[model samples]
Target: MTAPIVTRDEPVAGTPMLDARLVVDRGAFRLDLALRISAGEVVALLGPNGAGKTTALRTLAGLTPLHDGYVTLDGQDLDRPDLSRWTATERRPIGVVFQDYLLFPHLTALDNVAFGPRRHGLDRQRARAVASDWLGRMGLAEHARRKPRQLSGGQAQRVALARALAVNPALLLLDEPLAALDARTRLDTRAQLQRHLAAHPGATLLVTHDPLDALVLADRLVIVEQGRVVQEGDAATITAQPRTDYVARLVGLNLHRGRADGHTVRVNADFSLTSGDRHDGEVFVAYPPSAVALYPRRPDGSPRNVWPATITGIQRHGDNLRVQLGGPIDVVADITPAAAAHLHLGAGQPLWAAVKATETRVYPAAPGGSHPE
Candidate 1:
């Protein structure tokens, strides 16, 4: 952390948000999720497209009904399918910021924000005052008079956020809040949004596909895959130990499904690697791309994970070059540009790659679950 560039007051006390199970059936697409987000805390729902992230958000916001299970906030039953207890979207104490922002083009920034408070029963003057305060908090006070089209991408995003926060809801839902911005705008806007989310006293559920956004903005991550809770943990914990291949790829790790016994895991029918961490039954072996070393020949030493691969792709990765390979296990290797040049690396080139046993991590896939090789 470079001499902390920003500071925010501690979040205020608000009603603790949701602790619920959400189940919805949309024909073949069914979502079965269990989530708990604390007050004054931000949780990011991260997963692949159509992974039920948005569906869960909609359920929380009361836009979608539950097919089974229930939703509760601060012990208040929002939905109880078994009991037939349901709350309307407007009746739920929740605020939502949609992916496209959905700002009213006819209204100015201030009015857009005021719209929420106004709808919540605040008088015109009081609602405008609240909206003004939120705009100031978002650093968009001056843009308050501008319409959605008149504001820049970052400014519009801020206004949209302001609108959502103006209601002072117990739970805030943001669906791809920064997705509308460009790369440059996203960088700056992300920082700004982080500050506001930190100041929010209510629980926040952020839905995003970008790993950096989820890692930076949320206190915990709930990863759903194929409408199921695949993984859940803090950013650092999940980043360190990704249980699913989708999560491994999101965190930029080379992962393979395998069966483990002692320190060795058989990743494939013809391939097995020694791992420092011991596990039993079905397991996964993962290592960072940087852990891989390439050689022109089978320069073998003690690295147990060595394989012959053909370069399938090549691309610039930050200050280094990322070489993609196809073989027993498709893997990516990150090496310095100088080393790449020395090796004359290119697509279709055959090379040997190795990773020391200690560099790989092995963990049980699931306890008591069917062990799939």
Candidate 2:
């Protein structure tokens, strides 16, 4: 087995900033995910719990041993199973920010940020100077002397980020970066983190379960389910046509399986829908929660597709109400608070739901098929 040498700055067509064909087997659980990230691009790995999002990150960071396949960063072969070559975590040009914001309790903010550079063999003075600059960039210059316990959650996160970036790695990995912050602090920290990530020249992979985080922070999204990539696309594309129930629930949409003939799609034998676009064969039909109109009994107006649905659950979504309905086809509807009050909407309430043909979209499912959740 010989190590494959990868030359940087050698232009290759369609070459990504970081390319990894990772396969890790751990007893019953196996992760086989292929990922690519362009330079300066941020790709968010979104999935539910136990979906292997963290496992993928760890494999890329060399924290988890690869059972097969290879990892290439900036064209360098970090790991290659065929060659029996593997780079140690410290040797890999990557930075990682854990969920808990792992900061030394005894070290100050500056010292925490300096630790990486110092370990990389930089002089103490130079490392501190680099750390100071990062702290300044994160707007934590005033708290450089503060310890982990002394700093707020948001502040500590920033310090952790600065520490990771101070080493100037080729790839940055963040695992649930905002999971530790409070609601108010999370919002503020998200914006701040976005700004810093925007300026980073290296590729970044953010692992988060939050849809808002993926939509706001990522240029593209990669949704994994049960150790497989279920969907990968831009926010608009993924949001408009979620490939799984988890994604549909995240984006607040009713997703259904149907067979399409032109613009009409039939679902559940009894229910058929007219979509905005024309398509044939097996398809997916999706409509946003807001597109559904609920009626107390039955409306007098023209209704193409109206189904008698029973409210299965109700919750507040932003300024509106998210009502989950069950019938021939399960659906979620978003109605205004006033409408909800007027209709006396609650769990187990009977209602009729209507959606405009133009509001619905139908497209062919992916080649491998839709995600089963």
Candidate 3:
């Protein structure tokens, strides 16, 4: 489903500080996206690889030219092909933090953070003072003398963020800001990033593939696929009602779309499942992997949603086993280790998968209309 894009002429109150509809064309691929971020808000751009997330970010940062459409920040047009208006990257009041941190290898942390303010016309002493304050805020004051090579990954990330913020940018762009950190460091840095983002007065755009980062750091989410927006909303709303398989998987739900007749949804010619919620017309049925129960034998319980399937794969998911099954329907089921042992779960083993009708959530499939191919 495509999310609605608020137009510039729309009489909406509290217009977003960052408003843009980016359209860039390559030989075989095109990027068309509408994005808006209010002041003091963090919006996460999430999508699969090659979904044009980077293209959109680059276009907004003036690193890439817009094929059409416009990029407007705080009522000022940054890029407008139709109006022949464009702002150079260095001239725009924007800061960018690359995935690699992109710190100057030879410069000390203090000088690295001081670079942006200096480029923005600050004197050497004034820029260093601002950079020092930012480093202190990031809890990296003591590491100011260390070069990029001497700093830890998390410390380098903080230094990069300090540099980005030192210029007092009007818009901040972060591309996979924490993707390079280890799991433990990522967790700590994510929390720190959330605090810093909350304190920033300008709009911020975060691009990342990790759903956890998006869920934890963003005020809203914009999910794209194949160069078009598929969904956009608050984390809770998107998590509970995913519109596509990609989004469903991101939220850890097994989703299937089909014709809904009362409480039953016909996923395909050979498969139909019952749901607790009732809806007519096209609908999507979703249930978590944990909601599925697996059995070596056909379950002889009430008229529950049950199907015979064969194990396609199995992997450890935390303390549980995640089993992928293939039959009339392909699905993933989470079972305890004890249950896995009891069922002798293995690849190619036949099993029965059952889910309670009440566990399934049903919603209209085309609530927001279709998205681009």
Candidate 4:
């Protein structure tokens, strides 16, 4: 989608593109984070709200100062609080596309893209030339003369991205770059963004809570919660083995931590589950909600993990009904709409939930980590 956006010579891969640690103490909230990104790589900081995903982006861009730790990018020190070394946002070889796009209301898209280069010492004529090429590359040449108010959300977003890349930044930071668009626009823009990012040889950090964005745009995922990293890994690995309830829910899996002895894992004093895989000591178990089956009465045959649960909520999930069950274990169950009707599913209804052992996956939990809530 953005295959032609490389009109200006993009920077070649730089060694040690990003090596940083950031610490921000805000009296009530503190963030201590360390991260690294090589040239031509995209790393996503994924987490729930107030998890400090955007704060990390700001730290790397030098919009927020580090209380401790340092930010070294492409062999340059951007932040080293102890040494009183911190580069201002504009001075750093970084570009940030904020959640809101933040385009100038009165400026034409062309001028908006040219603003950065103009400020960075390029003459008006040359700046406009660069902007013109970028707008054309982004498939926005026709909209180049439109003011921010006249342009569509996706068009404005393209202009914002062009402006950021005009200076050939060594580090690219994006904060929910697609949040303002509609679902359709988001899908299209996301694909366009992926192409642009792939063309960028610099290190890219994307801050978002959307799992799809991280899965599609980033080469690696770093999940943060309460201002600390809970897990960091590739999409497939992290998706298969989430470390926290938040991560599990984000990835659409039911996960529980417990003590494992053989194929059985005790989730709590009141509940236990058997897994196809065996483990010892602390362990984690996960299963897809679709694997859960609801019965009006206790089943009479077949090996099953059965428990009594009260329906706390019910909603449509695509073609299935999502049943929120609360009992010894809190978990979501997906059932065909016809099955839900056959069982007369309703909030507060009593039902038996079962999952086959073969559907459950077991893995070792962090050695000393506490169980996730």
Q: How does each model score on lDDT?
A: 0.87, 0.87, 0.90, 0.88
TM-score of 2: 0.91
Q: How do the residues 1-373 of candidate 3 rate in per-residue lDDT, one tens digit apiece?
A: 1111112243245988899999999978988989989988999999999999999999999999999999998788999999999998987778899999999999999999999887777778988898999999999999999999999999999999999988777789999999999999999999999999999888899999999999999999999998999989899989998888899999989999889999989999999999888789988899999999998899897748999999999989999998999999888999999998899877898888999999999988776543523
What does candidate 4's lDDT look like per residue over 211-315, in tens digits? 999999999998889888888889998899989999999999999999999989999999999888889988889999999999999887874689999999988
lDDT of 1 by residue, 160-236 (tens): 89899877777899999999899999999999999999988888999999999999999999888888888888888
Q: Candidate 3: minimum summed lDDT over ten consecutive residues — where? A: 1-10
TM-score of each: 0.91, 0.91, 0.94, 0.94
- Looking at model 1, residue 167 earns an lDDT score of 76
> Looking at candidate 2, what is the lDDT of residue 318?
94
- Model 4 clash pairs are none
Total colliding residue pairs, candidate 1? 0
At residue 322, give the lDDT of candidate 3: 88
Give per-candidate clash totals. 0, 0, 0, 0
